[model samples]
Target: MKHIFAALCLLAAPAAAQNAPHVVTDIAPIHALVTQLMEGVGEPSQIIPTGSSPHSYAMRPSEARALRDADLVVWVGPSLTHWLEEPLDTLSGDAARLTLMDDDRAVKLPMREATELGEEHDHGHDGHDHEGEVDPHGWLAPSNAVLWASVISKTLADVDPANAEIYEVNSKRFAEEVGALEQEITAKLAPYHDASFIVLHDAFHYFEATFGVEADAFIVAGDGSTPGPAQIKALRDHLAEDPATCAFTAPQENDSLLRTVIEGQGTRIAVLDPMGDGTTPYATLIRQFADDMVACFSQE
Candidate 1:
């Protein structure tokens, strides 16, 4: 009887696994969106751990296992997490994958040259650097988040048809919440529309563009590559000529370098997390970003 029971348990394992669809997301913000959609249906697994920059992250053995076990995988694409492309192609080839950056509904921003710093800044025109280049921080745009929520819900519904209604309801609720948040943030940031700021990285272009915030320049490009000395000097010169009211740095960047650039400039230094660490709900993440910007720029 014991031998028979053990054999039966082994047979039941695969059946148990099929009870819920396993969805895997690349970063915390994407994971939050997926989790909100799958609230009453099932939970999604996140690959990138907290406090890690998606631009320079290395996947671990456990994350590899999670990728292999996932029924569906969602990510921003190679621009953000290039490290996962090869592994995901090999391991999760059969799994349904959604690259949010590739979706037509997503609003793709071009890679603006660092030298362009004002309201009438020119877009990058060099064809050599423009091909296949786009800002991968689409989640920072609330509209993109809403669009991604719809895509996620549709994908989840396809995999778990039994909970289609729940997914649909969640997606609609998420869109409504995001729309409301966008309005609230727009009003909150109205006073700072003319405020000049410098970001540690070029991740907030979408956010700034969406809300009419003036981000004068970013210290580093979108890929997290350090700027050359020449570029640093140019940034320093720009800051000196038309001083920024605030200089925002990500939690992962070096503060010393930022201080060196903004020294004696009277710019308030603030930390902005594009990844939305410690925030579970997607709405909360968006709100946190808006509030952080307001707090930093509103200071006297």
Candidate 2:
């Protein structure tokens, strides 16, 4: 009887594994983080194809089907991709949702204003009236990434209790890897205490704050205002005063205006890819950031 029961239990293992939840996620970073927890249990599918803007992505038929069939849907929340909110409610209504931005364990920071020459950033509000608005690039911070591992692990375990032990083990490994990666990057960037840079978008503040780096100035005001004559002149003047070693611009940006501003100022331009091409590992993305920033001063 014991031998017969052992054979039955062995046969049930693969059947149980086949019933794992079909988890779907948004963006590459979130997908990558969740991927770590699902190792040996199940793979998570990403809705956004990557290298695509989170703010504006037309869902493909496959992605739509994935959302519709998902057992769980994970995203950073509407702050980053408000467009996804409606789809989540209508299309993936039956799927369990995990919005990391609302998690209390994760650290949240307010949006910041473009700093002028000789102007100090207030860090919290920076004189901007953004009271309740929080920056959506929370994944850039390693600490938040660590918290997300646990959160994702717990959610997956809840949905697939049969794979709970696998999720727990993988999540712990993910946390340790991130902790070590942060320490190495922190020390690597420690020598850049006095270096400065320009950002096309105000997306890197979370990463900056985590590594003790700060942007010297920002071109766009984020209110949909174009860089006018006075704004251009202000940037020119700031460049003369606080010449940045590098200008960290986002992908798909037309940098001609920016190129004109720092033309003769000797600022090398670098691209900051927040969402990778759906293939970059989470650790690789973080390391690339530190490498780019360090290259800014090192190349000089």
Candidate 3:
């Protein structure tokens, strides 16, 4: 009877591994974090393709199927990708959902006002400038990243208790990496604390606040909309009045309007990969972000 029970236990372990839950994530950065937790377990499927704007994306048929089959679906709430909330309800409705923003511990920043140009027009991105709206880019902060690792592990453990230990362990390791990266980034950005720069959008405030290397003005809005003519002119005027050393644009989002604003200003243009470059470890991606900003700030 003991031998039979031992054989059954061995069979059950492999069965659990084979039945590993299918996990799906919304964006590359979130996917990268989930990938770390599932390192020895299984990989999660990413909905947004590489280099695509997470602010707006049309889900592919395959991705839709993945959601339908998913046992767990993790995403930053609709603030960053407003288009995803409906799909989550329809396709991934039955799956275990972890909306990071909904978690109380997730640090939220107030909405940044749109550029001066946006106000001239009746329509604008985050035009109000009031404190109610939350910046969707909260995942960029080191502290927030650590919080995500903890939340993600808790969410994963709730659904897959058999592998709860592994998830918790990976979350601890991820937090450790984030701590070291934060220290490194603080030192890297310290030299630029007083240096002035501009961003094509308001995506970096969380990161900037954490490291004390904030930008002087935003060329775009808190939300991802393109600024109107008035906003562009206002930015040009702002630059004319007080020039900045660099202007940063995100991967897959820069355009002629951005180029038009920077023309003849002699300001260096650099890319900040907020989507984690789709592949590098999340920590490495943030290090790259700091490196990109520092490199641009270092220019003459």
Clashing pairs in 2: none
How much is the lDDT of residue 62 in candidate 2?
A: 91
Each model's lDDT comes to 0.82, 0.79, 0.82
TM-score ranking from best candidate downward: 3, 1, 2
| TM-score per candidate | 0.89, 0.86, 0.89
Candidate 2's TM-score reads: 0.86
- 81: Cα error in model 2, Å: 0.3
Candidate 1: minimum summed lDDT over ten consecutive residues — where?
119-128
In model 2, where is the ten-residue run with the lowest total lDDT? 117-126
Candidate 2 per-residue C-alpha lDDT over 1-300 given as tens digits, one digit per residue, 9 for 90 to 100: 999999898887765356779999998889888877887766789988766767678999899889999889989998888888988888889889999988888889876654432353322222345546788889999899889889888988888888888999998898888899999999998999778788776778788889898888776543223455666676777678778888887674667777877888988998877666555777888998789778767883
Q: Please provide, for model 1 over 178-247, each residue's C-alpha lDDT reduced to its tens digit, 9 standing for 90 to 100.
A: 9999999999998888888888778888999999985787766776666666667767776787888888
lDDT of 2 at 219: 67
lDDT of 3 by residue, 190-258 (tens): 888988777887788899889998777776666776666766777677777777788888876755666
- Cand. 1 Cα-lDDT: 0.82
What's the count of clashing pairs in each model shown?
A: 0, 0, 2
Clashing pairs in model 1, backbone N/Cα/C closer than 3 A: none
